[model samples]
Target chain A: MTNKRNQIKGFCRNVDEKKERLKKAFGYILKDKGFGNLGVNKVSLEAGISKNLIYRYFGDFKTLIEQYSEGIDYWTSQAEKRDYSEMTEKDVLKNLLGEQFNYLILNPEMRQLVLWGLHESNYNTTSLLKKRELFAERLILQKADKRFDGRIDYRGVVSVLMAAVYHLAAYSSVQKANFCGIDLSQDKGRKRVLDAINLILDNIYDLNEDKKKATNDNE
Target chain B: MTNKRNQIKGFCRNVDEKKERLKKAFGYILKDKGFGNLGVNKVSLEAGISKNLIYRYFGDFKTLIEQYSEGIDYWTSQAEKRDYSEMTEKDVLKNLLGEQFNYLILNPEMRQLVLWGLHESNYNTTSLLKKRELFAERLILQKADKRFDGRIDYRGVVSVLMAAVYHLAAYSSVQKANFCGIDLSQDKGRKRVLDAINLILDNIYDLNEDKKKATNDNE
Candidate 1:
């Protein structure tokens, strides 16, 4: 009985190791080639696992994509978890923008995946909406202030932030237009872009204050 | 001699009328199908002009798109030209946001054309770049306040505005998700979004003020 139990334990351990290896391989494949043009056979071969194993673990190609998308959300959420208490508001804003930039720039596969989500009809309803909501919620939470009154409109802020971040990301990934018609490669241009973002934030905040004051005076 | 001169004048008038008709037809076609999937032959037929005439006037499909783009830009610029002299800062911001929203929501064809410009590889580079630069310059000039002497970062402002506007445009166009999470259709949600944007803007302006003060102290 003891010998049989040891054999089963060894088999389970081996299976867990193989699962880890497969997930690592999947990341590499996704990073190297975008999800839009990824091949199941290639992913299976790269992972050094059977095609059967892929189906067994992730069901099918669509399911695999769904799983991959979930993983992306998980990873992004993890990366975005910051200690907001220690950081200034400006620092937080800068970090948020910079991190988003880095993710879109460095991860071509993920960029392509997002584009695919935007374009492909099959992936449109389930994965894209889920991801978008998750992204907005995560972002809103990260930037939320404890002092924020329930009266303060947060949807508008999310809308603006989403617009800013997604537009920049899309441009960087696909449009390749430098912000403010300035050369992105130069330090001056970079500073100008950063300054422009700061200005936009200032304008929105000022507008909010005016609204708030009006509300207060009315009350 | 009088009869011949009268005939020539009549011919010129007819030609001018035909040109006006074709231009109007072009606008209709653009509004209906968008530049991304335009059919030149169909446009020519619908315009009641010979196919060869389209080629003769616009040179090619690419030139046709460029012409349409320029026309749309001119129209938007004209529409957005406001007498800012008497407007408060909050009013100005509201006007800008409202104008953007209205423009995007109303002008579906122009919006699609802009999206195509971002995606299509065959767009004329020089013309597109020129248009973009001109648009950016106009926005900056219209919004800039020389007397403020604050570190109003125009580039950052542009970035944020463009991001917000474009993202909203894109998302609204493709929004298929039901109202489960992040319900953008709701009034309360919309208010929250506006408030969030205002808060971000306030922070940006505050930073600008600090920077201006620092610059003055240094001098």
Candidate 2:
């Protein structure tokens, strides 16, 4: 009876150890160099855990990716919670674009992981799209309809606004040198990107009003 | 003397044959299933050309890519020449977005090559920026300044507009899924994309007018 009890305690310890190791493995994947490119065995070795444990916990690499993807919505919501209620249209856009730019620049690993996810479309693109749709519905389209006095096509307006902001982030992240056109090692380039996004937002608001007038005339 | 003349003529014939074979090899590389995943042997075998001849003409696969990249400017110019001048701002934006959307859908192979170039930074993206700068200077910035009484930051405005358009093209090319929330394969989705661009443009124009008035009041 004592031997069986000891065996049960040992099994519980093994499960606890694996759970701790898996959490560390996730952090290692996010923080360490060459971790993204490592195979499952290499990641297991680096995490000081057995490959079988990883398989048992995460099921497979793809399942691990799905697990990670499950957290994207939470992160996106957190990012979107920056207050825009009291700001001008220009201010709102500037804040939005600025936030995205800063996040991508500060989080190179996450940015790279997002790029990998973007490239691998068969993964969790639906989750990404869901997050995007939420941003559109809650932040951009809703705000535009509320602020504007005309029959504005909110979806259309938001699409351009979102596309512009996303492009700025992408350019800064992937082709920073080409997009910035100045010294990339400094914050000057980043400022230029923000300025560019603000300008676009200003133009978009003006253009939307004009279209509303023309549509009314036609009616 | 007669034998020597025959030998010279035969040498010229062989050179011509090699050149023809190299051109055919380039086409095969561009059009074949294993494009982008190319090697010297595969290209040589597919083109029915000698490996030595492929090396002689192209130096390496990288050189071939460089040669192809050099031709992009010509193609872009040709694509840009499609008439939109007679259309309203909305129609112009619509046609532009439509053309970009269709290009991605219709030309998957070319899209793949371009995406690869974007990721690899293979071509001179600076040249692309220069072309964009020239387009903005001549078309949108100068024209808007001359025609409108609005406070417009020409460079910023143009940059945002171009970036938004580019975002649509880049997303469509890389993702192969419609972010416009409509089926890109259907006509309705195509119209929605065009309409969205138009709405964004109209709003921008209105916002510019507002900015101009605000500047006037400050003055």
Candidate 3:
């Protein structure tokens, strides 16, 4: 009985050590920005573990990536948790774009993942992409119909708006450049960019109303 | 005298051949996208020339890149040559965004260059970036005050719009997937996206008018 119990304890300890190393490997992946420096050798170096151990724990690099991808919904789920029902249309736009921009800038790891997600990859990141689309639908598209009363292409407009927010954050991080004289490296400059987004959203509302009114008069 | 004349002719012929080879090397640069296949060996192979000849003509890779950079302004200059004074604000927005979207889709090489220019590089692509900004200033920023009437952040707004246009073009090229149900691969789908852009621009005009009216009422 004593010998059996000792064996069980040893197995549990090995499992725990493997889990820790796996977590460290994932951290390295996020830091490296989408498999730029990804290899079993590199992960082992970063995790302070042996190459054989990583192969033993994750089976292979593909399996390790698959495990990491399971947590991809964390950001999207966080965005979906917010309740925008009580907010005005303008406020909704502000909250959505502002939250996205802030989240991107604040979380560089997530930002890299999102930017990497935009490109075509052999990896199975389709789940991550789908989660983002579903979040956009729930948060922005459903409200867009009533907000603009179908005056705009809700999906396309939201896509452009969201894509702008993403590219702005990603571009500003790597390049010390400004977009249209608005400095992106500074918070003040990024805020102006957000304010400009709100103005564009406001424009959408106004244009929709004008279209509706003109149609009514014509009738 | 005859020998001297022959020497001059041979020298001129060799210079012209080197120039032709250099032109072919630059063409490979655009096609390769982000200098992935660019090197003395690769360029020489593409141009059907020897590596020593390239070094003799352009001195080095840096000078070869610098020579190519001089032609980067061709597109921006073409945009600046257009007369926008006679155009309405809506038409101005249309022409600008339309030209940009169409040009991006039609000219894949230019599109690749623009996307590649977004990231930091060892190559001297700064002049290309500057030319794009200057073109924006001339085409959009200079007329923004009159079009938006100081009600909107003209610079910021133009930046978002331009960024969106770029991301759309760049994103659509690589990924087979569509964002938010907008099929970027199809002409009809792209047209809907463009229409969304026009609606957003139209909103700017309407919002500015509403702001002016509200101010008048307050006064």
lDDT of 1 by residue, B1-219 (tens): 999998999988876676566666767876665543457777778788887877776677667657666666523454346665587564555556556654665566656555544443345533664566565456443455442453565455646665576556444544545212445434454444445555665555566677788888999
Per-candidate interface DockQ score: 0.28, 0.28, 0.50
**Per-residue lDDT of model 3, residues B1-219, tens digit only:** 999999999999988888677766776666553433456777777778888887888888767766665444335635667788888756876787777777776655565455445444335555566666666667667677775667777777767777788778756665556687677778877887788777777667666788889988999
Candidate 2: chain B TM-score against the reference chain B: 0.60
Q: Candidate 3 lDDT, tens digit per residue, A54-82?
A: 67777877667666654443345456677
**Residue ranges of candidate 3 with Cα displaced over 4 Å:** A1-41, A44-60, A66-74, A80-93, A114-119, A146-149, A209-219, B1-56, B66-74, B77-90, B106-112, B121-123, B146-149, B212-219
Please give the distance, in angstroms, between residue B163's alpha carbon in candidate 3 and its true position after superposition: 0.4
Clash number by candidate, in order: 26, 15, 0
Q: How would you order the candidates by TM-score, starting with the best? A: 3, 2, 1
lDDT of 2 by residue, B42-143 (tens): 767876777887667767765654454444332354445766577654354445555655665555444434333334343444445445445534444555
TM-score of each: 0.63, 0.67, 0.80
Cα lDDT, model 3, residue A65 = 63
Of the true interface contacts, each candidate retains a share of 0.49, 0.30, 0.50
* Candidate scoring better on TM-score of 2 and 3: 3
In Å, residue A97's CA in model 1 sits off its true spot by 3.4
Query: Tens digits of per-residue lDDT for model 1 on A1-219?
Result: 999999999988987776666666666876664443467788778888898877776667666666565556423444445565577554555566666655665555555455444333365234656665665455444354332344454445545754565555545544444555655535465556555655554454555577678888999
Candidate with more favorable, higher lDDT: 1 or 2? 1
TM-score of 1: 0.63
